[model samples]
Target: MENSLLVETISCTDGSLVGIATLNRPQALNSLDLEMTRILDKALKDWSQQPEVVAVIFRGAGEKAFCAGGDLHSLYDTMIEYKGQPASANEHANRFFAEEYELDYLIHTYPKPIICWGDGIVMGGGMGLMAGCSHRVVTETSRLAMPEINIGLFPDVGGSWLLSRSPGHTGLFLALTGALIGASDAIYCGFADHALARDQWEPLLQALQSTPWARTAEDFQKVTDLIHALPSIELQTGPLESHRALIDRICQEYDLERIGVSIAALSQNEDKWLSRAGQTYMNGCPGTARLSWELLRRARHMSLADIFRLEFGVAVECAAAGNFQEGIRAVLIDKDRQPKWEPATLEETAGDWMAPYFALSIDDPSHPLATLGR
Candidate 1:
């Protein structure tokens, strides 16, 4: 709309248009800007209504990332302006999350198949894009994580839905520690369905064009089967295998101090991955950690619509009072690596200071996503 070309749509041989939505900002890791989200929401909404558009393919332009996440710089700036008040803040924070969550919910309930080529780093907003697709593919080099805690944000891109259902307490551990997992772990956690060798990606793309399309009852299955038919990839069992027991132990304890202390203890682990993960939790914003834990707990039984609503509420609240601004300043703007969280300790992050985040105002029953999963 702004002539920025944030998303490019390509016509497929399947007929009128088998939408291929490419995230075009490679320099920024194809991150989702407000412009990009608006473009994607418009294009996908248009394509969803057209009968000739059999399926949609989502991918990134760069070699390094499918999408690292949403453009946090924009969010940081907007939050600074809005700061969580419903009346005026709704103009930015409310609208952004509302549109974003609407798009995510659409992807989940889409009648036609959606294929997300998860090639490289996929986190935060990136995870949101891939999570709802019917066919999700991972390459040998795919690096995936929720990683919201690092920025003083919970995994809002349907993170609560995906992570809550992860095997054992692995999701909780990942949410709090911002753990990065590989292709195999993605499949193990139900994040991805198929593995395609990086070298064979070209072949997969070619096959997509040559494949026949029909709006049959089994259209979704047919698309998924096509992707699965690609050459198999050998995925190494990453950290999840070795750290399963420890993650279960750490996450089963819901108390902020207990879980935080247990994970922080891993800072001394022999394994660098575990040690870094531990250090991440040891230093992450106390409010974000507690909020993530609560969301994951509540998400275990909520519907997809409810999860979106809940995430919207938390995101707005984070923008308003949580340490997200401080986190972004230290982690991105200042590069100082020192965020002064208000309630700096996990113990202090519990109780009233964290209540408003879970409460709903704009994200209530009359919310934009009320009929999301219906």
Candidate 2:
């Protein structure tokens, strides 16, 4: 139980090896649990320090999902206890977010290249893992999303930084609507680099291993060039490319009220996918949508380290506020598919109450993540 038999290493014929960390919970769709996060943090740290670890290949242990998301059921249970205790922010979600974000930041700044073979349902925490990797690969079957809005949580795990950097206002649409996208959509949004078919997984791994590697900056280039040289068919064109103009226009409206009105009207369009995305925004937790919007706005200039720090504070608060618990209950637990979100509508969701989540909660040098990116 302690070890994820799922997470292991792949040694190359050459002196170097690839650290292949698999999300092992296939039955749970390899959803990231606390144990998986902790194991990954330690494993990745070790891999990062090892000179022979040429790169790391991350994937999920399933035919279905790369990773569905976090272990929301566990998160919900812990959050309920946090509510019962009604204690300081430290007791709420600092442990999970701190470790998770630390791991994410490590991937972002890792000296060695990381290849995230992102396929199937890569959402929420899965997105965190894939976002920072040096080489992100997806297949036609890849169904990618943030989907935090559905569970009354904003996109954390450096979602702010990644989303903000995405082209145009597509990021805003995704954050609000939690729409699922495909290979090209991920590329268009800057979340992934390569799109290959499912059959190419083994061949790609072979390509990565057979390449003569050296421990130098040019070695990184070698890894990238090798990936490109692999036989890969073009991906199906994603919808984002066609909707770019309208998405940009809608996202350009900075005011939340105006954006809301515009998105609502856009839902009436003949395109069902775009219409569904709009409808999701209308039905999702208002608090989450509001928080996501503000986070993206402030995320533009944030350093990666700072973004993690900021996300920790905001995520911790969301835990204590009870919406995350209730939301997860509706979606993952009770499965009633109806969350009784407090301040049920955007107009009623208090900006004043949400304001605290945006503020810095920890700045001491001894903070767990203080040394991140150093």
Provide the clashing-pair count of each candidate structure.
0, 0
TM-score, per-candidate, Cα-based:
0.94, 0.95
- Where model 2 places Cα greater than 4 Å from the true spot, the runs are 1-5, 84-92, 362-367
> What CA RMSD would you report for each candidate?
2.2, 1.8
Tens digits of per-residue lDDT, candidate 2, 14-121, equal 878888888888898888877888888888889878888888889888789888887777677777666755424435267777888888888888888889999888
lDDT of all the models against the reference?
A: 0.83, 0.83
**Ten-residue segment with the worst summed lDDT in candidate 1?**
1-10
Please report how far candidate 2 places residue 71 from its true position, in Å.
0.9
Q: Per-residue lDDT of 78-190 in model 1, one digit per residue for the tens? A: 77776655533545777778788888888888888888999999999999999999999999989999887777888898999999999999998999899899999999989
